[model samples]
Target: MVLQLHVWGPAFALPSIDAQCLSAIAYCSIALPKDAWELIASSDPSVSPTGELPALQNGSTWVSRFRNIVDYLRQYSDGAWDLDRQLDESDRADNTAFASFVESRGQSLIDLSLYVTSHNYYNNTSPAYGNLLQWPNQWILPPKLHGAAKARTDHLGLSSLDLQAIEEHRQRDHSAAVAAGKIPKNLIQRPRETVSGLLGRGSSKNQFRMEALTADFFEPLEAMLGQKAYLLTLKEEDVPSSLDCIALGSLSLALVPELAFPWLRDAMRAKAPLLSAYTERLRRRCFGDSPVEVAHAYSPQSAPASPLPWRAPGRISIAAVGSTLLAELADSTPFLSEIRRNNRLKQAAADSDLTSVEKGAVSMFADSSKKDMYVSIAAAVGGVAALVGYMFHVGLISVASQEQEFEEEEEEGIPDFGNLSAGDILGL
Candidate 1:
């Protein structure tokens, strides 16, 4: 029986990616019994209990959440999903940790994408403070900032003071978004406008940062996948499964365009086909094709056929697949800390109380923001202490030990030789 997969969401947002990924998996000819795929534009409650997009309906069951859907589809395929390559307990934990990491970082990507689309804010321009002007019809401000003071700033103009006020307003707005479950709580918040403006400026430094981070993410996966056709599994028989494609597709999106990573720039240029496919799909699903045309204006390359197909056979049992499959695809890096720091500085500069000079200084030395100053300083001190201790243990800081010995010599305290037993005094 052809599976009746009802996808509920618009074609141009985060949910769209979910839709596309699922579509690709289905197209790969996975055994989803119901073959018909239905995409509903509106967020129907009957379709989704949470009233969110990308919900799936099969038979009597309605499944929401992207990961849940991925899981559901896998069950219909039985053990073909290969969650974590059938790892033992320890490897499974590692996989879970990695998944959590990916999910958090993925949320940031989603937030940035949503911010870019919703406000027409690009990484190169300032984001529109529309929420401050008028609350989104479906979203309500949190109780903390629902009063008259917030209302005043909501309508504030784009003057210098108003710009500053908008930044401050967004800080609270972000918090509200988190509380309302619009965003993940642990994810860091950066001023969408400022970040977009920086990207717009296209500074060499900013470009370098983008390239470095992108390389850090993708290079490893490329190496892992190697010439083998797949990352985790080697067999062609394993090729068409959703688990295989989703993992690769997600990784390809997260890390690509070696221009973002200078060392791999040449390699990425050579393998442009792999990267372009994901972005083009993203463009098609998010911005209208027009924006994609703008994005690829100078590039002469064409998008490749997606490796995974988008049709399935019967109803997929989502819950049985488990989180292990998703976990193995996550990226683990300390870059998140740096990203968070940059975001915090951006938020600090947007505070109403900060003067223009303060904002400038904070932007220049992003690590020195009031919000992170003490914490950063403490972390630095703790890191130094740890390094010194490591060096001491390794006999590298002999000078310090000598200085300590000298300090002990300068003290008036005498050795308590009388307390030492003969056996202790000996080398026994």
Candidate 2:
């Protein structure tokens, strides 16, 4: 059976919106032959065994995340698919270091550009996700992604990029003031500020900060690449290593995508032209220069064939949708919401290497056994049923009883006159 690599659907003229997904795509396209594997834009994380995307399905087993996928591919079929096997020990160490660097710093840069900035997120990133997802999913996935981005870049102290962050801080201060029985500032309301207007105020400062961030990521890669065709090998004939795939994935997102705030792209072109060119050159070589349009809404039918292996998402599993809905509902409930928040805080505080994307998926029943999880679900369902029942009993909600329905059907069959009494009713 052919291996299936499931990922988020294409958006912003890229194979995948996510950096990790793009990394996985590049690796697979290089490692596996054209007929050996197919790409499916599932756009659903629940399809993965690990509840994430860029999942590689080989027979019954599934592998998730770029690093894990790389490891799996390297070992598959007795090392037939290993891209880095040709590397010497020193080059291999460099590969490991560079890959990690790209994943961390590159991810931060992407998040800051696409998601951390309120203007870019609202006008570009969020809409890109919306185009990539179905109805309910489009609503849920963007905020979740945005939150993950915020968490990842929070340590960088670039709150000015997100005007909403300023608003949130204001709200918190107001709440504190209210609790302390103190008057708040600016009781008189002014006109609501546009994000563009606010952004105009700090455009230069934000530009400098964004450039600094992007340079930190791109400069080292440029120096490493130098004049070589790829990252690792110096000869013109050397095949691009796994590190090249990772770097290409990261840089493509940074350089591609015409965002509302095009600071990242501008920075790359100005500060690191060679790296930007390398990203574009590598992407074109792998996926062709033709613009890959977003596929139609997911269907059971296969996606349209192209130079690149873009496939429509498989039929969404009902179970996966249900799981997503349940998770969202749990987050909305007060007690469960608190627990979920605490779990996220704990995960954030823990010294784990999991990325923000990986860390945010806090299980609703993280501490509970399967039985307890089932019981909780059942209780929630039962409570909803009981609440509806109580509403009907108190006349807040009304429904015709079966007997009343039957009586109405009989009456409709034979008309009853107000002037006629019991005899007329009997005749009817």
Candidate 3:
């Protein structure tokens, strides 16, 4: 089936900013970063159904959200890299719990880092979408996404304190008046409250929120991952778990240099070595540090990069072929012919002599030794052809195989992480 994944793209992995989308796209079989993301965004609402990016359209099936998308992908790929493929029921439950916990605690912090934090937003996240686009899109998209993202964060009462504080104060006054047996009026006219007077966070609280949320997330992760390869390892020596995929996809954004919050990044760097190590391990295991994208655009400056185009997997592109098709052809035929002629001249210098002006005037035999040299040249051409063809095959296979890096293992499982309260896990 033709699998087309529509996500915000041209920047970050899977081409969009959302980490949940990253996890889902990472699990798909035929997933490639779609370059014309704005096209998808501008199209019908039915494309997404939920009015969200990262919607996957597979045959007749359509789904949104990372968890549901992954469930579908597991079936689609026949359990390839399917975390729940061989796990027992209990482990599966625990996996769900862990994912829920991480999402609850970490997703907000991610939003704060990208949308709310001024430093990271302009430097990394806000401008990211536009930077990936061509001229008009570059002009149009950043403001739209920025406005949408800011509106959501503003509603959280974290960023727009004045507005939230005003609303809250008005509500408080109305409640007070109703209790005192008078109808509330002119509450908003006074506008006496500052952000500090309300429950909404101010500058100090925003900083504290960053630190607190950072602590809430990584502390548990560090303890849960103590000296282990996998998050919910069945044995002490298992590779990364399904939970690891989600965790990595979510937390990996913090390490993103542009999107990274300086305070939170430092906190993770200083206090959460294990969690830091976990993301590093997952990056290597899942991506091998490479993803192939069909998207024509890439964000070298502000967005995430596409997997670099390559002539082969192991072979370097420059070594395999020249930059252009004509250049490559010249290198193979004319270039090879010139090299053979030079080699013959070098041998003659050491043994016999050959005239320098043997060409262009004396009527150089087009093929004086054509019959004998035909076999040798033909063999040389065949060797070069085999090398190119093999490299092409290798590149094709590498691109396909890389879509899903983690394999479904049989007859093994990861250890369960029992339910624990936030305070107990974070040591708060």
* Top candidate by TM-score: 2
Clashing pairs in 2: none
Expressed as tens digits, the lDDT of each residue in 1-428 for candidate 2 is 78899988777788789888888888888778878888888888878766678899998998887877888887776788888889999999999998889999999988888998888999999988888787579899899999989999998867677877777777787778867878756465445455556657776775566667877887898898889889998875777889999888878888888888787788888888888888998898766675555653244244444445555565667777788899899989866776666665554334245566555443323544344655877899999999998988887644456667888889899855767898767886
**Which digits, one per residue and each the tens of the lDDT, describe model 1 over residues 1-428?**
23333332222222223323433333323433223343332222223443333556676776655456666656755645434445557645644554454444433332222222223222211111221112221222212122322333333221221234457778898888989999998887774554446445655665465455445444544454464543344563443323344443343333332121122233344444454344344333322343221112112133123221122122223431222223222212244445555765575465324689888877777755434656766898999999989988888778778899989987747667888898888967
lDDT of each: 0.41, 0.78, 0.56
* Model 2: residues with Cα > 4 Å off, grouped in runs: 167-208, 296-307, 333-428
The Cα error of candidate 1 at residue 313, in Å, is 20
Report the lDDT of model 1 for residue 112.
28
Clash count, one per candidate: 28, 0, 8
Q: Which 10-residue window of candidate 3 scores lowest in summed lDDT?
A: 36-45
Candidate 1 ranges with C-alpha deviation above 4 Å: 1-3, 8-46, 73-101, 113-212, 240-243, 248-428
* Residue 157 displacement (Å), model 3: 5.6
* lDDT at position 45, candidate 1: 25
Error of 1 at 83 (Å): 7.8
